[model samples]
Target: MLATLDEQAQAFREDVLAGLSAPIPAVPARWLYDRRGSELFDDITRLPAYYPTRTETGLLNEVMPDIAARIPRGAAVVEFGAGSQTKTPILLRAIAPAAYVPVDISGDYLNDSAAELQASFPGLEVLPVVADFVRSFNLPEGIDSLPKLGFFPGSTIGNFVPRSGTDLLRHFRALLGTGALLLIGMDRVKPIERLLAAYDDPAGVTAEFNLNLLERINRELDGDIPLDAFRHEARWNDILSRIEMHLVASRDVEFSVAGRHFRFSAGSSIHTENSHKYGPRGARLMLLAGGWTPIAEWTDPNDDFAVILAEAQPNRFAP
Candidate 1:
């Protein structure tokens, strides 16, 4: 069994304490993918204002055939952050891979999705790997002969800065080995109003999603933090070409953790996440930087989002 919250996990918690207890509070977005946070994210995606999930799904439905065509027959498909495996069926129907691997940091949920998928596609093999694909990812050692296709269907790539995104893509390519195919979803830059609307939905679910990150910390770390002490704030950073999410302090306060006290000035904020919006040019540049060469791209009818197919470098696989 995979160790959950082991030594690395303990160190990660300590780092979170240090960052949050700083003169300014900052929490890494990585911590937000825990079970509670994962459920909150599912709720967030269902909100009317959150458009990435729906938009990306629509585009994928429109282009699954092309995605499948790019892959050779009887390929092995692996997905990262395979939530509910909801958006994957679109690709599965077209590609019908020899094996399906779904990897995610959420162990229970990943297994649940894998079980359901196994029932749905009995003929196809299903292997579920429980680990954070962001940190360090190593695929199975065998299967060198199967066509390895990486499917990152959601706009999850937007969570990383451009440089980090490049590194992540390179890591994914390296894991897949040479002659592998990648299907990635990317959110496009749109009107500022639209971008703002998607994050700050009318139902307030998005707000809860942002603040829940704090609650998640308090719950997991034995930290005493009044959830009301922090408020959710989302802003468009035009200069950075990204949407920044922060947990703003409601009042000047001092929080203690790891035997150390950290103070936050009222009105100051802890940066939690940044969602980068990319155009076609930016997307292609990012893929290239990550060492994956783009082979095909499909955009929404209105060109609101894009799903690009990139190939791992012929020799970049981790041998």
Candidate 2:
């Protein structure tokens, strides 16, 4: 079941208060997707520098027939994040699932997307669950009996650190139950220039997207963060194999959120997000660690991204 609006507000307050107070101040990436943030992100996906969406979509279009053939008909497709109108339609047409369950924290966007999707496929069932996909949430009641095809696309998995990523994959495994299948997209480690451009686009939309988080904080949690006091930064963390997004304090600045005050020195930053790129071996290994076995994989011509099909197989003892 979804939390009440009040409950969600409280969670936001608590998370922001605690996160800002921590030694290394950082907010969870999931909080970056309020309605305005979501809209900004939709714009980000279309920018010329943003290759993941286009690359993944084209790859999915090319391989989805094979993907559909491997799965049984009438399976329920449970998308971890809100369904993308652009990408979800492609998969839906190819798989022709009996039902589609899109779970997301943004209820309004979810419903709008769901309604549009339902119109596109009137015969199929479109169920939108309003909850954070990072946490455990029950799928709609009737779909439990159907085979689940977990659709986690757009390299959203990259948002979490490796350990958290593994835990999240295991959470998906448990939620989908044994024998369920997962089709996930993962971005590859590419040239630093390309990666940097993808995250920190020249057009400044990405900056708006990052700063909007602070705007959201001010709007929802009664924060007084000076938006201009910080700037958006995307850096490649070579040691960690991820792109880190940070909001750096341009000068010493103090802000209050939920009646709690916080200060940051010039050059200090609050890490807002991470996008971990994975090599083939690393991706497969991470899946195995998360209780899923990679069954098949597809990639674009440039090899900038991958869409992998994995299954929650039965556990076996190993020497």
Candidate 3:
């Protein structure tokens, strides 16, 4: 179930306060999805340097037939972070699942997207649940009767740190249960130039997307952030094999969020997001540790991205 508007606002206030209070200040990337942020991200995906979205979409187009074959017909398809549901129709048309459950943090956006999808694909049962798929939640009514297939595409898993990533995979394993299937998209390790370009596009769409977080803070949490005081910065962390996104202070500035004030030095930055890249072997190992066994994986021609299908393994610890 979705949290009430007040509850959601309170949680947002608490998270922003806590993150800004940290030794190295940081905010959760999930907070970057207010209406404006979401729209900015959609623009970011279309930028020439943003390869992940296009590459993943192409790979999905190529592999959906095979993926659909593996997914049992009449099964319940539950998708995490189903923004736009753009590539989803490929799988839906191929598999013809009994029902579609899309879980996203933005309730309003989810409803609009779900309504459009339902209209586009008449007769497919569309059940939209607004929640953070990273955490736990109950599946809607009638879902238990059908076999469950979890769809977590778009490499959103890359957002989490390693331990959290494993925990998220395990959470999906538990939710889907033994023998259930999971189809996921992961960005693969690539050259630093390519990785940096993907996040820091030349057209500045990505920069706008990153800076909009502050705008969201200002609008939603009654923040006094000066939007132009900070600039977007993206760097490839070779050691971590991830692209990190930050909002660096262009000049020394002070801001207040939810009545709590904070200061930043000229060179200081607030970390906003991390996009981890993975090799097939590394991804498989991570899935194995999370009680999932790899089934089939496909990659684009340049080896820039991958779509993996894995099955939930029996949980020995289950009572």
As a TM-score, model 1 comes out at: 0.93
Name the runs in model 2 displaced over 4 angstroms: 315-319
TM-scores for all candidates: the values are 0.93, 0.97, 0.96
lDDT of 1 by residue, 1-319 (tens): 3336584468468768777766756666776777767777888878777888888887777777777777888888889886455688878878888888888876766777788888888887888887778766566545567888888877889989988888888888777876788888899998989889888887877778888777766666666667788888889999989998888889987775545666777888988888999999999999888878898888988888899998887544322
lDDT of 2 by residue, 32-118 (tens): 999999989999999999999999999998998899998878999999888897899999999899899999988898889899999
Lowest summed lDDT across 10 adjacent residues in model 3 is found at 310-319
Tell me the deviation in Å of residue 24 in model 1. 6.0
The lDDT for every candidate, in the order shown, is: 0.79, 0.92, 0.86
* Per-candidate clash tally: 0, 0, 0
Per-residue error at 240 for model 3, in Å?
Answer: 0.7
Q: How accurate is candidate 1 locally (lDDT)?
A: 0.79
Q: Which residue pairs of candidate 2 clash?
A: none
